[model samples]
Target: MQAYQVAELTPGLGADERREFRDRALSSARNPSQFTQLREIEGYGEARLSLIERYLLQGTPDASALAAREAVALSAQASQYAKAMEGRYVAALLLMRRVLLGTALVTGLLSVTSALRALLLWRSEMDRRARREARQREALSLASHELRRPLQSLLLASDLLRHAETQEQRTHLLALIEDGAAQLASRADLTRLNDLYLDVTLRPRAQDLRPLLERFAAPRVELSLPLEPLVWPVDGDRLRQIVENLVENALKYTDGPVEVALREVGSQPEVTVRDHGSGLSDTLHGQVFLPYDQGPRGLRGGQGLGLPLVRRYARAHGGDVTLAAAPGGGLQATVRLGQPAGTRAETQAAGGAGLLQARSDAG
Candidate 1:
């Protein structure tokens, strides 16, 4: 009966079907001995098993192991990517926190600096206002003192002229009255007041020099000639004021004679007022030219504006005024003005005239 059953099974399966069954058994086995056991099965032929090992199992072990290892490596790489994404998110959060803090610190510093700048500006403005007020007060005080002297002189002269007796004495009194009236008239002239302020404050303009000097020169003060006329572009009115002020100052401060000399120095013409008064102190020399600056302590009744005005006028003319100890023991003030724009012949002529005047004054 067993032999009959085997023959029936063997006869039912074809050769190709038998070979496919052997290959499946070999592929499913975990070890070489498991394939050997499958080969010993009753219907499995040794020849079919040998064909499976040669065609299917041969050269396939290494390929199968490599495929399994690649799957495991892919899983590990996915796990590492997940961890890296988490780390990057944490780092981004830390950077964002630092940026926010830095912005706040910078904003606070800027606010403090702006406040300090505003405080400094306010303090500076307050200081300027205080200084301006002080200057105005000083100016008013000096103007009042100056006005008082001239008013008193006019009143005294008027009173004297009213009571004169003899004709000769009346004539002399009339002359004094005329002098006082002229002085009063000068004080009343608004133009003179404007000029007085301008001389010390404003810039000078080009003007004729000869007529300007002539207008202010005292009638008693004589001038010499250089045989040729000279011309210059200068601040005429300011120059006149400076000359008049210096001459008047010389007459007021000293008992000896005074002289004014004009000469040409290269392309510039210079006016020098020399007086036999006590010279300025070496220590106070530079200070004398500043506005509101006073001379020596002993020089009374002077408001200390004369030399400063002269300096301002000189500067306006693009020139300067200097003080020196004169050879005759007095003050020598030299005011230099640049030569005017004109023909060479005209400039020479003007220079000659200035030279003549200088010689006349020197004599």
Candidate 2:
């Protein structure tokens, strides 16, 4: 209505007012033909048709009224477009919300499942660690117990040495002191034996075991080996430890010569350490391999680690060590290495578990 009033007042306007109106209206538009100021209005159907007819018929258009009608039509059209755009925006927002809610639900489920798996793994690791720590403490306790006797003997012998009246008694006390000191040194070796024989790696190579056995031979030990090399894929140093422990045990038990023999029987290399003294009892065959499992008091003194370490080292290198009665008398300690199945990488990869795994296989 106001646009119509303006159209009517336009005919009465001075030239300056008309110029100002045209300038303001055309300012936002490029030119008359390109200008999009007017829009088609659906509700003004009859009036728009009448204007179109009048535009076709009239020689010159009633410009002010046409501009006013176009303005009114364009305003109505713009209002309808705004309403349609608002509806589209609201629909898009609802779709996005549903998608976001589904994504969040899936992510939450994944997180929960992952947390449960991680919890189970952590619990298993903690249990394994606890068991390992318990075994270590038990070993330390056994070593401490073994060390005590040798230490007490050393102190007692030194006191006796100082108070001895006869040179013969003093000499005997000095011998006792020497023996006790040697016992302490040998027993101390057991403390560090864990890293090599138990829960550790041993890099075995194809080498001769005969020279190693012969090298440990002494005037008191009757060494017997063939003139040829007794070669086997064995951890030589650890194998030497096994030979030394067996020979030392033999010499310690008997005053007579201890016999040490090395020979290959069939596919396996065999070692026999024989002493002319009472062998371990039949009941003690299995018991002897345990840590700090000392025999009957005063039979033979030891930290009791020799047999166990011997067995462990032998087993770790895919072999076995067993104690049994000798041919004529005394205990016979034998060692044999297991045949290689694969490579050294597989051995080290197993750490100490390979020893038990192989023993289980042998059994």
Clashes of each: 3, 0
TM-score (C-alpha, index-matched) for candidate 1: 0.46
Please list all clashing residue pairs in model 1, or write none if there are none: 207-234, 225-356, 230-350
For model 2, the local distance difference test gives: 0.66
Candidate RMSDs in Å, in order, are: 28.0, 23.1
Residue ranges of candidate 1 with Cα displaced over 4 Å: 1-122, 134-207, 216-227, 339-363
* Candidate 1, residue 133: how far the Cα is off, in Å: 2.9
Query: Number of the top candidate by lDDT?
Result: 2
lDDT of each: 0.59, 0.66
For each candidate, give its TM-score against the true structure: 0.46, 0.45
- In candidate 2, position 338 carries an lDDT of 76
The candidate 2 region of ten consecutive residues with least summed lDDT is: 52-61
Candidate 1 at 232: error in angstroms? 1.3
Q: How well does model 1 score by local distance difference test?
A: 0.59
Which residue pairs in model 2 clash with each other? none
